[model samples]
Target: MIDLAPWAWILLAIAGTVVGLSKTALPGANTVSVAIFAALLPARTSTGALLLLLVVGDLFALLTWRRHAHWPTLLRLAPAVAAGLVLGAVFLAVAGNAVVRPVIGAILLAMVAITLWRRRRTTAAPEGAAHLGTTLGYGALGGFTTMVANAGGPVMSMYFLAMRTPVKVFLGTAAWFFAIVNIVKVPVLAGLGLITVPVLLMDAVLVPMVVIGALFGRWLIPRIHQALFDRIVLILTVLGALYLLIP
Candidate 1:
């Protein structure tokens, strides 16, 4: 079982709450929780704890939007995502995020910059190789970042944003996608010695916070201005990336 100081547990609870909502309603806000949890705990432990909360959030998300998912998009990306996950597992077995986060963050930032630039240039959405390549690249990177720091939100968010999905389909598809992925991570994290019985126990104490946050996000999401919400997501992604890199 994992043990943490009181303050650390409190901080984790808060981060978990936001992460829950990010999964269900605010698709990009995950960067904030990743930054918060990584800043407060050992990178490995933070990854595990965040994974637990993600599962909780995943449950809420599926319950809310299970029917809304775009399964074709998810399937199209599955093979690459699996390849990325395998690479990420190998990386986590050898190195920590102290080296990974900065490199990955720089890459994510570059991707976002390129995406934004393309948006202004052709007035067309990102597509073809660049888009699919980013999917493959970021899929591995996403698994790596989440394995190390729970920081994949921005990476995935940028991909979804570039795809320019309608807001509801975007949020709904993300909900189902992450539900499956986060659950898969559980056994992986347990094998890595990051998840213990005690840690699971502590996680139960914080489940309520995740629920509340998800509920709040559910209510708040549809009400938000689409463009403004997307921009906020982008800014948070940058901030979350910076937080990990600098720390």
Candidate 2:
């Protein structure tokens, strides 16, 4: 574990708190957390460290929203998600995150574009093939990006949008999904030699921040209207993509 400067730790704490809130209050803001982690540490090590913190946040999210989760949808996505994870593992080994980052950004942008285009034509939820394809496609995108860079939030957010899920369900289901998936990702990342003790220590200090953020989310969610929540997610996701694309 490389000992970070105090300021770096501060930034990381802020990022972690934001991530926790995003998991519960907003869905797509995690892209900012990933960016902050990557900026503060080595691209790969940062990815590993953030995964643990995310799982902590995930637990909080799941506890808050588990009842609202859409298990049928999660079931449909399972096989496709597995396939994507395998492909993502291969991609991570073959090409480091530098190459993976831009691809993830492009995918997110494409999803956003498609969702916006379809929004005018029909507010009705996508079903059947379109739904399955989205699960597979976004699952693949999420798996690949998360494997290499811990940046899957936006990809999954797009999928939730297409599903036309109610705001709480979207956030709840996404929280459960990421909590389980990020936990599963830990041992895999450890096997890949990305996780290290120093980072673990950092994760420890960061846990409280995640808790605080989760609490904040719990308080905030009931007050805000559903439409406002979705809009915030969309705007934050676009900003996250732009942040990734910038030098």
* TM-scores for all predictions: 0.79, 0.82
Estimate the lDDT of model 2: 0.73
State each model's CA lDDT, in order: 0.70, 0.73
Over the stretch 101-200, how does candidate 1's per-residue lDDT look in tens digits?
Answer: 5654554465456545644754365664346676777677666655555556556665666677666677678777777777877888888877877778
Q: Scored by Cα lDDT, where does model 1 land?
A: 0.70
Candidate 2's displacement at residue 172, Å, is 2.9
Best by TM-score: 2
Off by over 4 Å in 1: 1-6, 96-123, 126-135, 224-243
**Model 1, TM vs. native:** 0.79
Q: Quick one: best lDDT, which candidate?
A: 2
| Tens-digit per-residue lDDT, 13-125, candidate 2 | 88888878876786555766776676567656777888898888888888888888888877777777777777766766676667655554555465456546655545675
Q: Which stretches of candidate 2 lie over 4 Å from their true place?
A: 97-131, 224-247
Clashing pairs in 1: none
